[model samples]
Target: MSTAIFRFYEELNDFIAPERRRCEFTCVLARAATAKHMIEALGVPHTEVELVLVNGESVGFERVLDDGDRVAVYPKFESLDVSPLLRVREHPLRVTRFVADAHLGGLARLLRMAGFDTLYDNHFADDEIERLAGVERRIVLTRDRELLKRRTITHGCYVRALKPPQQLREVVDRLDLAGSAQPFTRCLTCNAPLRAIAKADVVERLPPAVREQHTRFSTCDVCRRVYWEGSHWLRMRALLETLGC
Candidate 1:
């Protein structure tokens, strides 16, 4: 029986039981296994892995694991660049688009408020979410471990937090998206891109005082929902800041 040493780094540690973090683990293999297989077997989703170092050389998911291999896996980097060090595989897709599972509506709203293209619906079945992510190439974000385990899911995250704020932080940090976050760029009520609209265009829909006090206005391209820099925007901005966006 051949064995390998695996060490998961950074947020990937969250998938492991507390007792296993920052420690070398011995995994025995009865047959040849790709790095990808061993990684998921250890509970880290393949989508969350950005870099894999075998011994000291960078390799891709298909890299075969061998006896005595010292494997180190890391999540997406938030500050550091390792492009020059990669032996194979390209830099991770940096687009902030996401597709969420049914149980995470609040977290979905938070992501939308933070200006992410988050596709969410309470009625989405696990298979539908997986299919959408596969077809659209959106990063699947779900709390369901079984959903993340689906082989069809090429890009996905098994959200670790129940609280919406914590889940937001976990996604931001895991994807190294802090630098790309754009708060208030999307309609909070709808996932449509907000465009600046003249006050006169939406005046008919606004309250008398709202039209009188708020000159600046925006509209959702998809939903035609109106927006302005009101108390709600301020509260959302506060939430964004609290999220370290």
Candidate 2:
């Protein structure tokens, strides 16, 4: 057995025991335990960890824990430059696509409104979500810590906020998504990229007021839904502006 001192920083404390939070605590470990094993053993999903240090030296999750070792685990560094440190994942996902769990439908739509490729289906099961995320190389956005803990999920985030708008803000800040956001470019209902359509092409489907007043429009390639810069669009745009995207 090995005894190691562990300290988790920032929001990571949310996953640990109240007595162990924001302070060093001793953990008894099996001989040759890896940092990954120890971290998951404490209930913090490995996907949420951006960097880990053992004895003040940067190390990967597979690094072996030693007796009296001091382990400091940190969540994703939104503003900090830790390129010199050892990160668990080899590289970040470039496209930033996401698959939200069944419960985060509101957030999924909001993400779509922000022009992110967000996949959301109210019927998506945990297994389906996991499989889709892996195949599509999508970042899992979910509130279920247990789901995020799965080994197959190499990239994911546990959303901390409760309300949809707050959750969107949290994700935007945590993932540094504001800069990448391209608002109103995706179909909110189906998650498809919208292509500009000639007003004449969709004019028959538009409401009388929309047909007379609106000359610009876009449509979902997947669901064939028409989109226009109407009152709803203005309202949604205002909301996204408040989020600074």
Highest lDDT scorer: 2
State TM-scores per candidate: 0.85, 0.97
Model 1 lDDT per residue over 93-169, tens place: 45758999888888889898888999998899888898888788788998766677677776777788899988988
Candidate 1 colliding pairs, count: 0
- Candidate 2 has a TM-score of 0.97
Task: Highest TM-score: give the candidate number.
Answer: 2
TM-score of 1: 0.85
Model 1 bad stretches (over 4 Å): 17-19, 87-89, 242-245
Error of 1 at 19 (Å): 4.5
In order, candidate lDDTs are 0.83, 0.92
Residue pairs of candidate 1 with colliding backbone atoms: none
* Lowest lDDT 10-residue stretch of candidate 1: 87-96
lDDT of 2 by residue, 1-245 (tens): 67999999999999999999999999998778999999999989999999999999989888999899999999988678999877888898878999999889999999999999999998999999999989999999999999998889999989989999899999998888888999989999999899999998998899999889999999999999999999999998888898889
Global CA lDDT of candidate 2, please? 0.92
